[model samples]
Target: MKQLGSKIRGFFNTRLGFFALAVALFWAKTYWAYQTKFNLGVSGKMQNLLLVLNPLPTTILLFGVALYISGRKSYITMLIIDALTSLWLFANVLYYREFSDFMTFSLIKGSSSVSSNLSTGVMGIMRASDWLVFVDVAILILLLAFHVIRMDTRPIKKLFAVGVTLLAGLMFGSNLSMAYHDRSGLLTRTFDNNYIVKYLGLNAYTVFDGVKTAQTSATKANAKASDMNSVLVYLKKNRIDPNAQYTGVAKGKNVFIIHLESFQQFLIDYKWDGQEVTPNLNKLFHESDTLSFDNFFHQVGQGKTSDAETMMENSLFGLPEGSAMSLLGTSNTFQAAPAIMDQQGYTTAALHGGVASFWNRDNAYKSWGYDYFFSKSYYQNIKNDFLGYGIKDKLFMRQAAGYIEQLPQPFYAKLITVTNHYPYPLDKKNQSIAKTDTGDKTVDGYVQTAHYLDQAIGEFMAWLKKTGLDKTSMIVFYGDHFGISANHKDAVAQLLGKDSFDDFDNAMFQRVPLMIHMDGLKGGINHTYGGEIDVLPTIMNLLGISNKGYIQFGSDLLAANRNQTVAFRNGDFVSPTYTKIGSNYYDTKTGEQLKKLTQAQKEAVDAMTNRVTTELSLSDRVVNRDLLRFYTPNGFTKVDKSDYSYTQSKALEMLQAADDKNKTSLIDKNNGKSTMNEYKTDAPEMAGLKEFADSYSSSSSSASSSSGTTSASSSSATSDSSDKDK
Candidate 1:
């Protein structure tokens, strides 16, 4: 036993042996991260084995630097290096627990604000098991302290160190070659950071992130104020005049923007198994009070849903590569919907079921000048009412009703639904639609969840009518993005009975439902080529607000001479005549390649392409350089982010509503009782759930009348009122 111990000690005390041990420790931590935190998406055995082995070369090269010194200096240098690396891994572990994403250099630079803005009571996210991440470091420290592993006096030769580093470099080069062969453009076109960590390990991803951050910073620094003049001139030149007939048609009305998650336009009147897939949406779409667009497309990029939001709110494009909300949202200045409406005496708020910090929305919304933001913390019943994203659509709508009622009149509110998101999971009891046997489970399950979302919308609409909010509000419903991805194109083609699907079909599938419903409007189905970027300008026109002074990239869709060219983030665009993608132009009318073009046609296409590219580039520059800070519109006031605190917003809202008793607020009208019970849905998650019954039990029944007069219990009324008030 003594002999064995002596041999072990001797092995650990040598410089080469210690280097090997450091490499092994790094490998262990990398493996731990892969197993516990990262969603590497490794499918095959070979990929899994490669991931396990990928970290070795990088680790050896990094730890090899410690061999330059001998004795305690070398040992201490290695320890410090390992400690920092472990901390980096640990930080990523914590961040991935909440975001399911890796950290970037930009995120690390802004970590101070990120840490401060973390939602209160974050201890729930930290698990006792997470502490295991540091156990290896602790063991190493203990071994050093107890003299079980001694610091050697011998130094590694410089020649040997250089040879090992060169060997590691060669090994890493081989690894990259293999990764590139397996996943083409593994380093170049990696829009998704997860791909980097999966293919090349986290250390490589961090280095890449740092390089990208430096490039972004340099770009921002090099951007000149004079460059914005051309962008401004282009925007002014392209601006369209609002239609004389429809301008100010719904002025001073409450606006309810319902963001439908992952809903496609095909689902509007689509039928499954001889039954209507979205009966209520179909009814609304056909109603004379609703204006429905059949050709509205969602022009989102890698940011997807968040990109759609960015365009709808700011009349700007999302970044070409990553999410603008995640990368530039905290720092960029935006002349968004909330701020624009706020200029017209509109009280603006955003209600979402998910965490506000998911896409850094808590901070972004503040920058956008939202009067209030009711996120997951504001919801009353979300314990078991959640799926992968957040609270289920039915419960989220039902819970949102009370808060919606509390907002003052002339309010601009947005409700973001999440039930119909990717990997659409639905409770078996709630699924009323029969699944199609398309042989693809994801495509098959999509119908059920979309059907469930429709039901939730139906219930929310009914509540609006019951509470009389429908009478004063212009409800704008838009599908955020496509539910089904391109991976399921074959199955979708089979389901849709298409002989063969092409890029044209894929582009057409990007169409999402956009409907504007109000009581007094003469609504009709309009076939106009518009995208999410056009929504803000269109709505502003209807609300008697002019967006002429703002740096809007999109024109009002309701304008007579509206630019119908919809530019996608990836340099692709769709016009009335042609769809151009990567030097190839397809005739929109016939869906065929344009083999030949007249001089006029060529000039027109070139002009459109230039406009699209310029618009995207200008938007990127504005965001990346925070140019809005230097260029505020005529009627706009810069938002003070310090004025908003998502933590105390509920109390502030209640107090404000109570103070404005004579004004139109749902709380005052409902006699300080919640209207959650007025919302009814066939969601399976609500089965036998009676938690909302006692929400407003403390309020006296005899305090106020049904006429919405101020009541005695109004002082004790809170945002968490019971659903039993009905």
Candidate 2:
């Protein structure tokens, strides 16, 4: 042991040994960050290898520069380089905590206005282990100071430095080649920033982001009103006339958009061990007053849920790369649903259980003209209230009932649920059903989490009835994106009882549930092919709102002659007649590959492909160049973002100040009292918390008996048998 220690110390006396040690330490630190801090969706042995090996190339490339310097200056330069690189990583760590995305140069340049609040914001988001980011630097500095690892004063040869640079280049080339082999168009058609950092390293991703940001900036700078000409022409030509049967049916009613996170259409009627996966949702789907679409797909790219939101709100597809909400929605002008509804005398609000900064929603909602944003701070989060992404669905919905009752009548509200998110986890006490035997842990837990979300929805729906909100509101429940990724192909295939999975199966698995329910509207399952992009137009038609002057790329799905081609984010298109996956084509009905296409089939494919390509390209142009700033639809006023604040005090003040008699809030109608008692949940975490409707009514009755008089509000709080599920 003594001899080995002496030999290691002897090697540390050499310059090359010192450089090697520094590079190894940096590599280990970066890999640790990749594993612990970021959710990069690492899968497969190849990806695992890449994750371990990627940082070495970048570390060598950056630190190799110090080797060119002579004597103690080389050691100093290396330490400085190490410190700066580590600082950048730490900055991304902080940024990722808020945005769930990496720090881009564009974001940095745009953060000057918030610099004063940086200290408070940083403190709020700081984790206990965040200090570990600079621990290696401190350790090295201390070691040198204590002379435990002496800094060699020997000069390095220029030839050796040049060789090191070559080695780094070779390693990076190899990594890039492997990544491309695993996922095509990794650089040019970049989808997720996580993929970039996972396949390469943080340093490479930063450089890539810098280049993309510059390109986007240039595009926005040179954009003109004339550039919108092509987009306007395409939309006008493709616009669908609204169906008279559905048009104006929901006009003047409240709008409730319930976002079911990570939900897929297959779960609607699916069964496991003879038990329904989503019994409540299934009932909703089969209800007489619901308009359900079985062919609806969630066409989210790497942005996933945020991409779905962008499409649902603005009829604009997410960027082909990262989240549009995080990258452009904050600054871009949007003729969004909230703004249009606000102009039509409706109060607009967004309710989410997650942080306001997730996907940059706090700023984006304001840009979209939301009058109120009830984010994480608006909810009471206890120890067991949170699970995957944010607050558990049951607790979030129960708490959100109070906020919903505060919104004035004829309101447009969006409630985003996050319990059914990826890497689904549920506590033993909270899980209502058994997990699936899919072998893959992620897929197995997905079923249980989904079941929990369904129960939450059932409870909230009953609450809406108990409070009489259902009488005047139209609730729309839609899945945001797929819960299981393609990485779990074997598990998914097993669940479906299929022999194997392919691109065709993967494409079909993108279908998500879209159910719109009203009090007395005629409803049935519609098989029209559509994606999230079509939601805005479909809802607008039902609300008697004309999207004629808006530059929306989607057609009204209720229209008898509306287009049925649904475009995916990756340039794939699905139609009732055919489905295209990569370069391959298959008959939608027969599921047979089109190896030999007839002339007519070839022509049809060419035409549809052109339309899909043009639409995606135009949408990308709209977001990347911020082209909507150039035009505003008639009867619409551009939103002033400064008029809104999402703080607890400001949101409550706005709710209290609403004095319109014709559009009084639910709380006002209920004698200015809270309606939260109407909501009930079976969540074990909420045990002993007694605000359930039946219990509240029983207590009210007892009080009335003691007082010998019943107030009108108390009398109306009795349980209704009609509200119970039959």
Candidate 3:
């Protein structure tokens, strides 16, 4: 034991031994962060092994450089490198906590804009345990100072240093190979940063992001005005004329886009424990003035909610991998919905209960040309009023009424609800309904949160009617994406009463509710199939606006000859006649996989697939190449992102200034009195508040006055034609 201890001490005396120790500590800390701080979605034995192994190659490669230097300088250099790398990891930890995403080069480059507010956010999310990331560095410095570990002044052999680096390179190659084997196109086609960090290490992801950012920059740099010609030609050739019946149906009306987070179509009239899951939504879907579509799917990729927003606003698809809003929207030119509405003298605003930095919405919204953005900062005194993603739906709606009333009449307002997000959570006091018996906690809680969201929407609708906005405005409620992933297939199958879940079932499960409610409109559930990409063109048509010269990939859903094939981000598509999931084709009507296909069916599938591919590829090109910069559609002006700011004071100042000048704001029309008290919510946190106490109730009966809103089964359009493509 004495001899072994002496030998260990002797090894620690060498500079190489110190480098080895530093590498071990760095690797250990990274693995700890992976397991504890980040949710990399690690699964399976292979994935687990990869997660454990990924950090080593980068750590070795980075630390191995110090081994080439000689003496005490090498030791000092090693510590410096360790500190800097640890700082990077620490930064990501804080960043991930706020955005649930890793930091990118663009975010780092734009750090000057956020440096003032970064400290407060950093401190707020920081934990005592986070200091542990640097504990090893502190310990190593102390060891050297106290002479517990002596550093030898001998120089490392050049050959030995080269061999060490070569070893690291080989390790990284093997690591990447395994990652690619586990998930094809892990680097190229991923939408979530977690996937990259899960398969590769954080350092690797950073390097990959830098390379991608550079490539995107290069693509935009070489882009020319002529590049937009082919895009324009394709859109013009494929454009569908608006249907006469629906044209100008909502001209000059205020538009409210309600983004239902993680909501799915099956929940609209679904029963859980003998009770309607979304009773209010079910009622709204059947209202005479409501145009609902059960075939509407959310065509979001890895960007999820952000992807849906991008598509709905700009008629653009998100990047095949990573979020376009985060990666490109900040700098890329956009003729978004807000910009379009702004051109028509409409006040454009987006309200969310989450932080502005989540998905980089603050910068992206600016690029989108919104006049105002009411993020979490705008809604103050949020004492336990939040859940998984952001503020509770009821509370958010109640608070948003103040901001909404302040907006000018005929404004375009986007309200994002987050209470129904993943891992749906509800306090005991807020649980007005029972959880489902799906056995899966995620599935069970989804019903409760969805019901809660419906209740909130119901109350908000009542407030809208009370304020007379409902009579003049059009409300569009659409789900962002699927709530439950295929990971909980068994629970989903049990809830859906299916024998087994397959790719076809998963494809169909992507359906999300799309309901457009406007007064004086005779409406029914449209059998036409469409996705989020169709929203912008449909809105433009309804508003009596022509988007003829714009580079939109979607056509008006109300058009008689509109395309019915909805394409997903992953090259899969669904049409009225057939659905393609992975490499398999299925009959849309029968839900039967078509292993044997007739020549006609095969030809049809091939044509649809080609169209989907073309559309997605074109959208990708437009965004990646920043093609909008080269083309300005007729009657459209390029958006100046610098003209917008989302700070609380700035937003209020702009709103007040606009209202004073035009007298068109709803609050101005109402004689400048605050209408905050007019809004009500059943949120538990509002119970003690005297002003809202009278209006708050556990039951959602207040919003029942919307005619024909019943908790009955969905009303089918008996005579509606299913073939809209013709």
Candidate 4:
């Protein structure tokens, strides 16, 4: 029986069969459906898709080499590739918004592009069953890779198969364990793409419905049976009315929300040869009601700006453990600002300088309640230089002003700007002097473009003032994330004196500028540490709007009464609180803090986490059913301040302090103060940190020559930043 089985396997693993299959990939037409409903032209989507998948040639080369070397057929390898593609496709589509029509095999099977273009279903792979496709396909790929690769060597094949099967089993078992972990509530499954792909059998990069439905079901079930009320519930228990305290909301006013891409605190720190690069932003900070929360952090990094927007505008967070904004699944369940504002009877619109559907921002904006959406398509003519990502922030803001003017009575407009973005090159080739590289930019070019973008903002402010709209317009501007991640820390350290404060050395990514300007806003810099999550409640307070029993993670910044701002990551809190007077990040459950100077930050984060997760449990039911605006379902509960444990708090403190010490040490090392890491990762933070000492050392290109300072790049201004804007 064994001999016969071996013969059959050997027969199937011939070189000709392998070669035939390898050649077939070229013939197998992969039709990528138009991401946008409006057609660009023939082969437009295909060409763009190929460009997006630019590494394909390298991948094919690798496969070709592998086949030639190991005599492993490319066709056999394709089985693995196919499996992986399907798995990734499944994972990508797992989110409700991302999983459009072609995501389904039925839609893509016969078509040259995808199978379907449908964009309706659950929000994400919330349920546990969502992982099955990837896990199973991954298992098949490995089993087959070993089966084909070792067909010439029987013993090796057997051993490899066994080992792979065991590993897959272990991963599958661990995933099952996580799924069952009660503390994780309904989000304990393998929700992360990295985790699933690394351990599962095989994976495709496709976006399918991840384990979202199962998670929702389980969480809803858990919430239904729970006795605890989250902060929202607690707030309901002890509600406050802003109508009684402050004046009413700005009803007949125009609202401007500027979403700056990759705008982190480090940008200010990273100066262009000892000059504050962002003069306009610096000036705006002084003039605006700057709430400089010392310990504020982005809830979802660069990957989830929309999630941040959702949190900021609507006063809500997505599901506990996943990217609420990732366009993965079919169901459209985004946390939208315009939707809520629409509920308030406000004219709503979103403006950006990129394609409307790049991140499915248009679809997101549809339910987001934007009465109008102005994307790259709407622009009269865009400078399509090295349009790597999107367009200039200046153009976006300029267009946004026009949109705001078009709005009737009280309008809510979200304008996402791209300038001060990554590959922060300040040259003629990139961004038209919007400066792409954070380190060695052609300063004149960058400054010129930045000046232009800043002038745009200032000019808009001037316009508002001249039109008497300043009295009625509420402008909220903030950086989406850190720019380019180079020289930011050094710039900051140089300004603050790396030794000035131990806090700013590390986590420059978390450092962002947030300012709210309006006639009614009490102008002053509130240095209380906070993260992006705090913005929603802060806005609510400024607007004299109550928490609405929905937004629990945010705090009413206007309230003299105490409230905490919380944030989440990987289904748990890094530092949960933002209500503290000073900068510090702490875990509420373990009491293990990140920034230890203040205990208040940890408490606030913990309180916020408790509220957020508890709210999530309750929201599970309504999230799938309700529109984007009506998210925070009531009946949730927040733990009392006393409920926090001490040891957990202290541990977080120690970790944060240690982190601070380590970062300061690195900053010193980078600045010739101490020794540098022998092997540094080519990461944004490290690059930024490294630039502190060797600032602008990488500007060796003659075409991008440097004189007194780094010049702005000639590429699209804020293209990278605009991509992050929801």
Clashing pairs in 3: 190-321, 191-322
Residue 118 error, candidate 3, Å: 16
Q: lDDT tens string, model 3, 144-228? A: 9999999899888989999999999999999999999988888765545778899889999989989977887798889888888
Residue 416 local lDDT, model 3: 99
For all predicted structures, in order, the TM-scores are 0.72, 0.75, 0.73, 0.54
Name the best candidate (by TM-score): 2
For residues 1-726, could you state the per-residue lDDT of candidate 1 as single tens digits? 999988877898888877788778778977887887665557566567669878887788788888877777877787787778778888777666544457776665544433432432135346677767667677777888997777777867889989988988998898888778777766654445666777788888888888877887888778777867887888878778977788899999999999999899999889989988899999999999998999999988756677889999998988755678777777777899998898788888898877667677888888888888877656654335666666788878776665566676778999999888756777777778988778876678888888888889899999889978898889999998887766466878987889877767777788999999999898999988999999998899889898888988888877786878898776678977889854468889889988798898899898887778788888877888778877888878888777766764454544354336545667557766656566776766666656443342222222122332212124223323321121
Better of 2 and 4 by lDDT: 2
Clashes of each: 2, 0, 2, 133
Clashing pairs in 1: 695-722, 696-722
Task: List candidate 2 stretches off by more than 4 Å.
Answer: 1-67, 70-209, 380-383, 592-602, 659-663, 668-676, 691-726
Which sections of candidate 1 miss by over 4 Å?
1-212, 221-224, 595-598, 648-662, 669-674, 688-691, 694-726
TM-score of 3: 0.73
Please, what is the whole-model Cα lDDT of each candidate in the order they appear? 0.76, 0.81, 0.81, 0.43
- For model 2, how does the per-residue alpha-carbon lDDT over 615-704 read when each residue is reduced to its tens digit? 998998988889889988888899888888886655665665663344377766776555666677787877865544444434333321
Q: How far is each candidate from the true structure, as Cα RMSD in Å?
A: 8.3, 8.3, 10.4, 19.8
Error (Å) of candidate 1 at residue 215 is 2.1
